[model samples]
Structures are given as C-alpha cells and as structure tokens.
Target: MQKDEQRNIILAIVLSLAILLGFNFLTAPSEEELAAQRAAFEAEQAQLAEDANSGDPSTPQLDSTLSAIENAAAGLTAPLDRSEALDQTPRIAIRTPKLEGSISLRGGRIDDLTLSTFFETIQTDSPNITLLSPVGSLAPYYAEFGWISSDSSIAVPDSKTVWSSTVDTLTPSQPVTLFWENGSGLRFEREISVDENFLFSVKQRVINNGSSATELAPYSLISRTGTPELLGFYILHEGPIGVLDNSLVEVDYDDLQDEKLIQNRTTGGWLGITDQYWLTALIPDQEQSVQTRFVYTGKGNTTRYQTDYFYDPVAVSAGETVTFDSNVFLGAKEVTLIDDYQEELNITDFDLAVDFGWFYYITKPMFFALHWITGVVGNVGVAILILTLAIKIPLFPLANKSYASMAKMRKLTPKMTALRERFGDDKQKLNQEMMNLYRQEKVNPAAGCLPILIQIPIFFSLYKVLFVTLEMRQAPFFGWIQDLSAPDPTSIINGFGLLPWDVPELGILGFINLGVWPILMGLSMFLQQRLNPQPTDPVQAKVFMLMPFFFTFLLATFPAGLVIYWTWNNLLSIIQQALIMKKAGVPLGRQPDEA
Candidate 1:
C-alpha cells in the first residue's frame, strides 16, 4: 500500500511538471517578435527626439520610456554624458585616502566624487563607484551650501555664482576657502574642509560691508536632479530619509512627489537622500534651531528632490561677520564610519540612516555579530559559518527536545494508524484516540514546530543584514562568490557563465537564475526532511516534498550571503535531527499502515 501511495504521488508530480512545461512552451516569445518590438521602440524614440529638436509642436504625443522618464526627472531636455557635463565646470581637486574627486567651484558643489575603495564591478580594473555628478550630467546629483533670505536686496551665491578658491585641492589638513562678493556690499566666504573618509565641513561666513544691516538665513541642500532608479522593495528604503527631533523619518521618492513637500522645525538634526548603498546628508549644528524640509519639484518628466534646512536668520551689521557651520556627508554608508561621525560630531540618531527594517532589534545585532566574527576569522564566508554555529548552540537544547518528540511521534504512528482504521467513518473517535495516545506516550506533535517558529524572525533579520549593509558589499566568499550583497553571478543556465552568451533577466523568468548555493540549500532541505516521518495525508506529504524546491527558486534572486545561511542552516539541522532521532531510539524504516 505504501509503495502504491508513493507511485500515485510520483504520477501527480509528473503531471504538474508536464503542465508547467506546456504553459512555458505556449507563452514563450520568438526572436523575430522581440527584435521587431525593440526596433519599433527605437524608431519612435528617434522621431520624438527629432521633433523636439526641430521645435515641432504637432509631433505625436508619446508615453515615456524609462530613459525618458529618468531624463525628465533630471530637468534635462536630453541626457548628456556625465564626464562631458563635469568637464564644462571649473573644479577644485579633492583628494583623500578613501575618496577621489573634484568639487565644482562654479556652483560650490561637491558633485564629482567616487569611492576609492569600491568598484563598479568585481574586475580589478573597473572604475570606482561614482557617488555624485555635476548638474548637466545625465543623472545630476549634488550637495550645495548657501544662504536663503526673504530680503531681495541681499545677494547670495547661487548655482550660477562663481567663487574663487585659494587652494587647488581640499584634503584633511588643507581646507579650501572660497570667496564670492555679490557686488551688493556683502563679502561671502566658504571654507570647505574634508576628512580622510566621507565627511565634509562647510563654514559659511558673511560680512555686511554695506551701511544697512542684512538678515540672511544660512541653508544647506542635497539635491538629486532626477528620480534615481530604486530597488522598489518594501524591505529597502531608497529616497528621502532623515532624523527630525530624534525621530527617524523615511519617505519614498514617489510619496514626496505626490505630497509635494513635508516640513518640520527642530533645534538640530540631520536630513538627506539615501540610495541603497550611498548617502548624501546635510548635518546642521545640534545646538541651534533650524527649519527642515523635504521638497519635490514636479514639472513633467523633469523633477527634483531636495532635502534642505535653514538655520535661524543671522543679522550682520556693517563690518560685522556671522558664521554658519554645517557638515555634508557623501560616500558609501559604512557603519563604523557613520558611528564615528555620530560620536565625534554629535549628530542625533545618525546611524538610523541605514534601514535596518522593522526587525532592527534583531538585524542590527546580527550584523554586528557577523561583522565581529568576520574581523576575527578574516573571511566573511567562514564568519557566516561560525555565526551560524554560535546561533545554533544557544537553540540546541530546544531543538533537541523538539526532535526527540518528533522521533517519538514517528514510533507511535503504527498505533495511530490502527485507531484511524478502527474508527473508519468516526472522525471524532479517531481524534479522541489520537489525543489519548499522544497523552499516554508523552508525545507532543506541536513540539517540532517550536524551533521553526523561532527561526522566522532570525531568518528575516539575517536577510535584512545581508541585503542592505555596506560591510557586506563586495565581500568575497571563496571561489565565484564575490559581492555577498548581490545576487549570485553564476547561474544554472549558460553553464554558469562559461557560455559566451548571456541570459535575459526577464520579469518572472529571472527567478530561474539558480546558483550553486541555492541548489545546495534545496538539497540540504530535502535530506533534512528525510529525518522526519512521512505525513499520513497525501496532500501534506506533497507539500513537504515540494517545499525545498519552491524555496530554491524563490531565494535564487536573494543576496548570496542570505542563501548561504539557509544552506548552512539546513545542513546543521539535518545533523542535529539525526543525532536526536538516534538518541530517542526511534527505529528508521518504512513503517506500514493498517488496511
């Protein structure tokens, strides 16, 4: 009977597979059709560009393409290469141990910078990760500091204003001081200082040279010319984020665009725009009060997102000078760096910039523990293994108890089967007998679920750590496993990148890019399942059998580090279950059912 039951289950699986394959075969698009669509789209874009250039209002209206949308968000009629845009502006060199770039002197903008330690790809010769670019660039993003005043008589330096720099390069020891006179009796001085890492100190000082006193409000702004490409997942926040009065506030770009503007008044706090891995923030003086605002200017495809703050107005009389001090943060979101800055600068809740998700309590600890382990072991992959063992050690006692109970339940399955047969149509009687049997045998069927329930939060927290932390960016794990925060580069298709051709990361089909780690995870889960007794219900058995396969596909696109954890965890569970089941003396075999 058991053999027959197995055969029937196998047949059902085969039928399901056949149906799935048939659907794929029917829906797959042909090469000709794909090429035709691409050609038509390109032709339409060319015509639109031609019409716009010729000033033809009668041109056919067209919906926006992704590139078009990005350009529109940037307030650019057309996208220009970033290098070209940066070349148009005069710049002062900025050099540090961890960063290399030139700050634009024309707008006094730190808009051309890249991380010295990070790269665009795994290749050693790849370019560094560009953090900011000039305004005329394809996707212009920058940070600027100046004064905003209600009084029109006072002239303040703006985006078009040109400043003369005393120094050629800004470094940790040498700061660049810029001078700009509005020709309206005001002499403006900006002294820009940078640390070896990513923090910039900008001191804005104004001297009222004219006879009348001037009231000007000092302000700092970090603006992204276009709506950036977002990860668009709920787990990650990629837009305007800030700490207002000790409270963390995060709003998506779409939300800000819809709401138009959000404002708050606080004595002091930090505000900024955060990408998945990078950040650009304006840190105001903690001792002084300021007005903060997150604003979005939406005009067609060209839009702008600005996170800005204004310090209380300063009244400077003739021959008197007032200074406004602030910090500009632009670089990779390194935890240790941010923590140091927070401590040194006393920025309130600055570390909250990294979205630890709702499970911050768990995720933060998980990251710190892993980070510590990595420091000790010197390899992130080995550290993950050690961390998994550390976590399992504490839960060992609970897991042992759960497995012992599961083994006992397997041993009692024979008696339970007999009760089911005896009570054929009497479901109530069968349940009663099963309960009495469980009580007598001291077997708790729910015991096995406790460990799994406890693991849910742990899994989510670890997943969050792997997904968002900069410490894990480009972290290597043995061969072919570079960049733990990214999806596995190798795929089952194309001979794991050995083939000359590439696979299309199509919408739903992207899930099929299973790597070596995810496959091992699926196999480990299957072996682990064998330690437990098969369910009496056929439907339940099928679910248990298919769970590993379902998870294999589902997690293929997740970060490689997260998938490695699951694989390692499954192997550990299998070993632990084996030991517990053997200790319980639960005989392993095909236990027969009553007929």
Candidate 2:
C-alpha cells in the first residue's frame, strides 16, 4: 500500500512537471526562425504579384478563379441586411413638409432628395455633421456637413460656416455648437461632438423670447444608414442594472462553432427587436422614467417601416436639463469584447437578469471566484490546474470510499466467475444469488461507477471554460502554441510544406492544422484507462478502452486549450486511481486475489 501511494505521488509530480515544460516549449519561438519565415513569405507574395502581372494566361486565370471562390465563401458567411425600405408600399410622410414651429430651422423638399443625392450632399465639405449611406457597395460612406438644406428658402449668413467638406474635428473634449433663428423670434441652440474613437453626444437648448411663452416639442431629423424602421431610429439603453439592446437577452454556447442565430418571439409582450445585419441605436436609461420610440425604414426601393415604443420612458422635464449617455459599439460578432458592448443595443421581449436563474446564480459566481484565483496565479494554465485540484480534493472522500467498494467487488470476482459457470444457462437464478450476496456483504454494485458519474459535470464544465471563455482566446502556452484558441502548431508531416487538407489561407499556417496537443491528449487518455481497474465484464472494458481513440478524433478540430485541459485531467485521474488502489492494498495485476 505504501509503495502504491508513493508511486501515485511520483507520477502526479512527473506529469505536472512535463505539462509545464511542454507549455513553456510551445510558447517560445526562435527569433531567427520567425524572421526568416516572414522574409520568405514577403518574397513569395512579391513573386506571385509579379507573375500575375506578366500576362501569363494560366496564372491570371488561376488568380481569377481563386478570387471568385474566396468571394463566394465570404458571401455565404455574411449576414443579410434588412434595413432597406423599398420592399413596402409608400405611405404619406409622417411629418409636415413645411416648417410652422415657433423656431424656423432649415427645412427641405422631400422630392429633391433621392437616397443617392442625400448621400452625395453629405459627402461634400461638412465638418459639423456627416451622412452615411449603404449604396453602390457594402462599405460605409461618410459625408461632411454642407450648405444646402431641403428647404432652399433658409439662408445662412455664411455658407462656409454652415458646412465644411472636411472631417469633423469636434471631439468629446471640445464640442461644436449650432444656432438657428426662425421668423417667430424663437432661437434654438445645440451642441454636438463626435470623434474617431466612438464618442457621440448632442445637447439641445431652446429659448422662447416671444411674450406668449410658446411651447415647442423638439425633434431633430438626421439621416443614417442602418436606422430601425418603426421609430425611424433605434433605441439602445444602458444602466447600472444591465445593458439592454433593443432589450434582447444574451446566451452562451458550449461550442461557438455550433452556434446559430435562432429567432423566437413571445406573444402579448414586447417582441424585442431583431437586427438582420446592423445595429442602429444605443440609449442609456437610469430609471423607468425614460420613454423612447424607434422607427426603421428598410433599404433598396422597398419602403418598410417598423415602430417600437418604450412606455416607461426616461423623461426630461420642461425647462429642466437631463443628460442621456451611453457608449455605442459597432462591429463584428466574433470580436467578443466589442460585441458584448453591442449586445446592450438589442431589444428583447423579456428582461435579462444578471443572474440567469438558479443555474447562473451558482455557476456565474463560481466562475468569477475561479477566475480571480487563476488570474492571481499569473498563468491561466496553472490556474486551471489549481482549480482542478480544488475540485478533486472535495471528492476525495467519496472517491476513496468508491475505490474501497470496488476492491471488495474485485475480491468477489472469482466467486462470481464460478457462479456464472455453474449457472451458464440459468442466468436469472445466478443474478438473484449475486444480488443476495451483495446485500449480505453491504456492497453497492454501482459503487465502481460513482467516481466517474460525479466527475462528468466538472469535466464538461472545464471543457466549456477552456473552449468558450474569453480568457483563453489567443492566449499563449509555450513554443509553437501561440494561440490556445486554435489548433496546436505543427507541420503536416514534419518536413511537408503543405498541410494535409485545404483550408482558408489565413493565420500563420495558411491552413487549419492539428498540432501535437491532440496526439498527446489521446495518449494520456489511453494511459489513464490502462492503469484503471479492468471491468469484470470484458466486453464493457474493451468498449471503454476504445474511448480514447474516439475522443482523439473528436478533439482534433477543437481548440488547443480544451485538449490541454482534458489531457491534464486524465493525467491527474491516473494519479488519483493509483493512490486509491494503494490504499485498498491491491496489487498491480490483471486480476485480484479471491477473498
């Protein structure tokens, strides 16, 4: 027993040391080799360019074919845009064409504005405001402020002051102010600021010099590319409780590769907004007092409008100043940090609680706790190891009892074999006798499976953490393993320059390559299983032994972090099993001695 325990401890230490060394080796790259590789790639690209320009018919044709394939692939993956208004029948314009308010600001004729024309006008020199359009191509176009208004009657003292065709220099630090005076002796002033680094703000100040103290409900009309149809705009809210994107809830997935956007709407409640391609608005609300409406117009000759109303609106009192602030995020979904911020803009029928439910109530807090501990350790890999140890320690007593129960079962195996032989054709009677014997001995037949059952959830949760958590994304372990979020680094066949299969030419390898991690993972699984007690049922044991191979195939396409976690788990399990067996006074042999 002492010898077995000592052996288990030694094995555990050795395995841990080996994993650390492997990680170190994977992260460090030889500077000379990297420099040489970069130079070679540059030279190859230059050569390819020169060849393509040499008027070689075959080369040009090949390039065209490749380009077409790439475009087709991109089109397949890109989301469909739903902001065009051309699909629906035209309705009467909601606002009046002519201005009749206390303050007369610039107004325009609806007929003179084509989507293209409006976009063009903004493209001209405008410093205060910009116009963005979604036409000609998918790329976004920015337009500067211009002198012309929809109503040509309103003239500014200086056209140059009204608009500048250059990029707006107004930043969050210093804002631009606009003042307008109408025939009714009403004056309107607003401050606006926008910066390259996502900062947009607007403040409106209205003053009524008229003796009647005329009341005016203020509204501004600004054209944007991806506005929601119903409210003629989108609303995004941020608050201390949580962020709401058009009010939609967020979800997490075990495998991002398996994720698909599934739309579900609830009846008799806010259906919440769904964005086909682009998100349009962000609003910050501190209290239930905020009320806003979002209207969207679809793109491309189809004029469809959708409206959303927020009843519990955050309000601004008359003659009282209130500030609405929120950070707006726009970009790709795969970029998680940015996307998380953008998610606040989505609207959903149901409110999302920070704690998802009892499940989240438990898991999220635990996740944070584990995250803190791991982060303090400096290396996430080491943190994971420590977490694994922490989990295993709590299960030690249960696992130890299970092992003892299994030892008793092992002692009875010879007697069971004799009984089986005696009742070769009387299986029912043999089973009844075996049950009676187990009851008399106070042994639970399922005891051997307990440890495995108990460990499954922890194992799966670890898998989720390693694969889905942002912490592991692009994290480094050791030499060659530059990105834990990707497959291990390895050549197709040692010296083969080409990978075994064709993959998109991105990243360092130019193809999806499975590195040494999966291979090591499989080996560890096999070793752990070999060291475990053989099942009394030979067929079951054989099936169990094949699991390592199955896992190897499944893991080949998974992130390296997952493979590393599983490999370490198996190594630890082997150590635990050895210790358990030692405590049971069991010898390392194919079969146990009869009781």
In TM-score terms, which candidate is top? Answer: 1
Worst 10 residues of 1 by lDDT: 53-62
| Model 1 alpha-carbon drift over 4 Å, by segment | 1-80, 497-501, 589-595
The TM-score of candidate 2 is 0.53
* C-alpha TM-score for every candidate: 0.86, 0.53
Backbone clashes in each candidate structure, one number apiece? 3, 66
lDDT of each: 0.75, 0.39
What's model 1's lDDT at 448?
63
- The per-prediction CA RMSD against the true structure, in angstroms, equals 7.6, 16.7
Clashing pairs in 1: 72-301, 72-302, 73-301
Candidate 1 lDDT over 191-257, as tens digits, reads: 9999989999999999888898888887888877556644445567889999998899998877987
Candidate 1: how large is its RMSD? 7.6
lDDT of 2 by residue, 292-374 (tens): 22223222221111112122222333344433332221211122333343354433322232222323344444455556775
428 Cα displacement, candidate 2 (Å) = 1.8
Q: Which candidate is the best by lDDT?
A: 1
